[model samples]
Target: MCAAYGEERASRTRINPAVLILGFKIHRSLRMQQSNKPEEQSASILRSR
Candidate 1:
C-alpha cells in the first residue's frame, strides 16, 4: 500500500528520484524494525542474564 502510494506520487508529481528512493529505504527500515521488535526483546533479556 505504501509502495502503491509512492508509485502514485511518483507518477503524479515531479519529485526527485533520490528523494523517493530515500523515502522507500526509510520505510523499509521502519518495517524491519517493527518485525524485529520481538526478537530484540528476547535478545535484551538474554543480554541481561
Candidate 2:
C-alpha cells in the first residue's frame, strides 16, 4: 500500500512541474506580445501564481 501510494505521489509531482513549465512558457509568450518589460511581468506572474 505504501509503495503504491508513493508511486501515485511521484507521478502527480512529475506532471505538476511539466504543467507549470508549459503554462509559464505560454504565459510568457503571450505577455511578451503584450508588453515590453518581461522581467517585471514574469516576476508579477510568478508572484500571482
Candidate 3:
C-alpha cells in the first residue's frame, strides 16, 4: 500500500548518511535563519511523528 511505501522511503532516508547529513544541514540553516524556539519546536514535532 501507499503507507507501506511511504514508511519504507522514510526509513531509507533516515538510514542514509548522505541524505541525513543534507537534511540536518538544511535544518541547521533554517534554524540559523529563524530563531532557536522554532527549531526546537520543529525538532520536537519531527520526533513526535
Candidate 4:
C-alpha cells in the first residue's frame, strides 16, 4: 500500500523521487521491525540463559 501510495503521489505531486524512495524504505523497515518483535523476544530469552 505504501509503495502504491508513493507511486500515486509521485505521479500526482512534484515530490522528489529520492524522498519517495526514502519514505518507502523507512515504511518497509518499520513494518519489518513490527514483524520481528516476536523473534527478538525469543532471542532475548535465549541470550539470558
Give the alpha-carbon lDDT of every model. 0.79, 0.66, 0.66, 0.77
lDDT of 2 by residue, 1-49 (tens): 5444545665677567776566567667776776758888897899999
True-vs-predicted CA distance for residue 31, candidate 2, Å: 0.6
Off by over 4 Å in 4: 1-14, 37-49
Cα-based RMSD of the predictions, in order? 4.7, 12.4, 10.2, 4.7
- Write the residue-wise lDDT of candidate 4 on 1-49 in tens digits: 7667767767887888788788778788877777668888798789999
Weakest 10 consecutive residues of candidate 1 by summed lDDT: 29-38
Model 3 TM-score is: 0.42
Query: Per-residue lDDT of 10-34 in model 3, one digit per residue for the tens?
Result: 6866477776576667667765655
Scored by lDDT, the top model is: 1
Candidate 3 segments exceeding 4 Å error = 1-14, 36-49
- Candidate 1's residue-wise lDDT over 1-49, tens digit each? 7766777778887889797788789789777777668888798789999
Separate clash counts for every candidate: 0, 0, 0, 0
Error of 1 at 11 (Å): 12
Worst 10 residues of 2 by lDDT: 1-10
Q: Runs in model 2 with CA error above 4 Å?
A: 1-15, 36-49
